[model samples]
Target: MEYSESECHYRIKIILIGDVAVGKTSLLYRLTYGYDETIRPTTGYEYFNKFYLFGDEIAQVHFWDTAGQDKFKSIVTNYYRKASGAVMVFDITNRASFESLKDWYKELKKFGEEAVEVIILGNKC
Candidate 1:
C-alpha cells in the first residue's frame, strides 16, 4: 500500500547500486511494481517512488536505480551523495559480483552521507 505525498510525513532517498546484470533493476521493479524478466539494462540512472511504512510513519522513498556498467560509474556516483540509504545488490551465484561489493561499498561511503544505512541483497538464488 502507498500514500500520496501529502499524506506522508517525510521523504527518504535510497539508491540501488551494483555491478552490471546483478539485478538491481529487477530488485527495484519487484519491490515497487512487480518484476519483469525482460528488464533492459539501465542506461544511466532511473527514478522510482514508493511509500513504505516505517513504524507509525510512512516515508516516501525516492529510489535511484543506477546503471552498473563501468562506463556509467562517473554518472552514477553523482547520485550517491544525498542518499539516506542504499541497497547494494549482488548475484549470489557469481563470485565476482559478490567480491565487487566491497568496491561498491567503498564508493558509497566515499560519496554518501556519513550515516547512510546500507542493506545487502544476495539476489538470484
Candidate 2:
C-alpha cells in the first residue's frame, strides 16, 4: 500500500456517472470506506484516493463520485475533463436508468480525454 514516488507507475483518474438514486454513491462508499447500510445521494461530488499494486507496479487510483441529478449534470461533466477512465452505472431493475446511459456516454465522450476507458456497471443487480 506504500510506494515511494519513484515506485509509482500509474496515476489514474476515474469518474462515476449515472442517473439519480442509482447507487453510484453507495458503490463508491463501499469501495473506499467499506459497507454502510445507509445510502445517501451525492450532492455535487465526492472523491476517494487509494493505492494498489499491479504485479511489480504501483498505481494511485483516484475515484470521483459525481451527483447523478439532472441539476448537477453540468458540474459532474466538468469533472470528466481529464478523466482516465469512467464507470457508467445503472440500476438493473430501473429501466429509466438504463435509458440514460446513452446521454451519459455522450457527455463522457464530449468532456473526457479522447483515450479514456469506460466500463458499464449494472448496480443494484
Candidate 3:
C-alpha cells in the first residue's frame, strides 16, 4: 500500500515489559524486524518505529523495549507515559516471571495512558 504523510492518522505506541531473560527483546525483534539468532538483551530501553496498514488508514507504531532488571524499573516506568498499548511478557517455564505480571500491569496502568490496550505474552512456550 502506498501511504502518504497525510494518510497516516493513527499513532500507536507500544511498550514491552517483563522480567530479565523473558525474551522481550526477541519478541520485539521478531515482530518488527523478523527473527535473528544474534538478538541481545536490552540494557535500559530501546525504541523501534514501523508503519502498518490498518484498513484504509496508515498507522505508525512505536515500540519500546524496556529492561527487565530491577535496577532499571525506574527508567522503564518513565517510558510508560502516553503509551497507546503494552505487552506484558513472561517465560512459560518460570513461575516467578508469571507472578510478576500483576506488578507489571499495575505499573502500566499507573503510569501509562488511561485507555491503553494491554496483552499478555508467554514466551519460550
Candidate 4:
C-alpha cells in the first residue's frame, strides 16, 4: 500500500492530580501556560490546549487540571480513570505532603492502571 504524507495525526490527554497546594496547578501552568510561582491552584478543573506539529500534521494535547482536595475526592478520582497519563505532585517543603505520595500513588493506581503513564513531581525539592 502506498501512503501519502498527510494522514499522520495524534492527540494526547493528560491529567494532573495531587493534594491541595501541592503545586499541581503551578506545574501545569508553568509548563503549559508559562505561568510562574504567582499562579494559583485551580479551584476545580481547568482545561488547557497544547498543539504540536509533526511533519505536516498537527497534534493536539488536551490537558485537564483536577482539583487536589479531599472534599472533591470522588470527582477527581473519576477523572483519573480517563487519564491517558498523570502527573502526581507533592510539596517538598512539607513533610506531610511528601508523605502523602504513597496514598496518591495507591489511589492513582486504582484509577489509572499501568497503562497510564505516571510522573511523580516533588516541588521545591
Candidate 5:
C-alpha cells in the first residue's frame, strides 16, 4: 500500500502519565509548545498537538497530558482508553517518583489500548 505524495497523513495519540511533580506536563509543553519556567500540575487532562511536515506528508501528534495527583488517577485512567502510545514520566531527583513508574506502567497496561507502545521518561527538572 503506497500512499501518494499528497495523500499521506499521520496522527499519533500519546498519553503522558506519572506521579505528581514528575514533569509530565512540563515535558509535553517543552516538546509541543516550547519551555515555560512555571510548571503546574495538570488538573485532570490537557491536550497538546505537535505537527511535523515530511515532504508532502503531514504527521500530527496528539499528546494527552494527564494529571499526576492521586485525586486525578481515576480521571487519568479514562484518558488511557484510546491512546496509541504512552510516555510514563518520573523525576530523576526523586526516588519515590522513580519507584512509582512501575505502578504507572501497570496502570497503562491495564487500562490503555491493547498493544499500546510506551516509554518511561526520567526528568531531571
Candidate 6:
C-alpha cells in the first residue's frame, strides 16, 4: 500500500545510540526542533514525541535521546528494548566511533528484539 503523507496512524519509538560527542542530541534537536547544533548535548536521556497524520490515522514518533558514554551503556540499552527504530551516529573524523556501531547493535539484538530499523548517520557526512 502506498502511504500518503496524510494517511494512517502509526506509533514509532526510536532511540539514538552512538559514541560520545557523536551528536545524538544534536540530531534529535535537528529533527524535532529544526536544528541539532543549536542546542547543547543532552545528558542522561531526553524524550520527544511528534505526530504524523496519515489520512485519518495519526502516527506518533517517540524518541529517546541517550548518553554516549560507556558508563551509560547499560542504561542506554534498556531504552532500546522496545524501540521501533534506532539512529546510530558517529563523527566522520572518528573511525573508532564508527567501529563501535556493531557493539551497540549487538547489545540491542541481544535483547531479542529484531523489529528495529536502523539509520546510521556520520555526523560530518
Question: Please, what is the TM-score per model?
Answer: 0.92, 0.92, 0.91, 0.80, 0.88, 0.83
Residue-wise C-alpha lDDT for candidate 2, range 1-125, written one tens digit per residue: 46665777998899989999888888888887899988778899999887889888899888999999889988888999889999999999999999999999999998889999999999895
| Clash pairs detected, candidate 2 | none
Off by over 4 Å in 5: 1-8
Measured by lDDT, the strongest candidate is 1
What lDDT does model 2 reach? 0.89
Which residue pairs in model 1 clash with each other?
Answer: none
Ranking of models by TM-score: 1, 2, 3, 5, 6, 4
Off by over 4 Å in 4: 1-8, 36-38, 54-57
Assess each prediction's global lDDT (C-alpha) against the native.
Answer: 0.92, 0.89, 0.90, 0.77, 0.85, 0.81
Pairs in clash, predicted candidate 6: 6-54, 6-55, 7-54, 7-55, 8-54, 9-58, 10-59
Which parts of model 1 are misplaced by more than 4 Å? 54-56
Q: How many residue pairs clash (N, CA or C atoms closer than 3 angstroms) in each of the candidate models, in the order given?
A: 0, 0, 0, 0, 0, 7
lDDT of 3: 0.90
Which lDDT tens digits does candidate 4 get at residues 2-74? 2333443767788887789877777778777685767776777888767777777776677888887788877
In angstroms, give how far residue 62 of model 6 lies from its true place: 0.3
- For model 6, the local distance difference test gives 0.81
Cα RMSD, each candidate:
1.4, 1.5, 1.6, 5.3, 4.3, 4.5
Residues 1-125 of candidate 3: C-alpha lDDT, one tens digit per residue: 44555668988789999999999999888887899989888999999878898777789888999999999999999999989889999999999999999999999888889998999989996
Model 2 per-residue lDDT at 31:
86
The total of clashing pairs for model 1 equals 0
**Once superposed on the true structure, which residue ranges of model 6 sit more than 4 Å away at CA?**
1-8, 36-38
Runs in model 3 deviating more than 4 A are: 1-7
* lDDT for each residue of candidate 1 in 7-125, tens digit (9 for 90 to 100): 89888999999999999998889988896888999999999999888899888989999999999999999999889999999999899999999999999999889999999989997
Better of 2 and 4 by TM-score: 2
RMSD of 4: 5.3
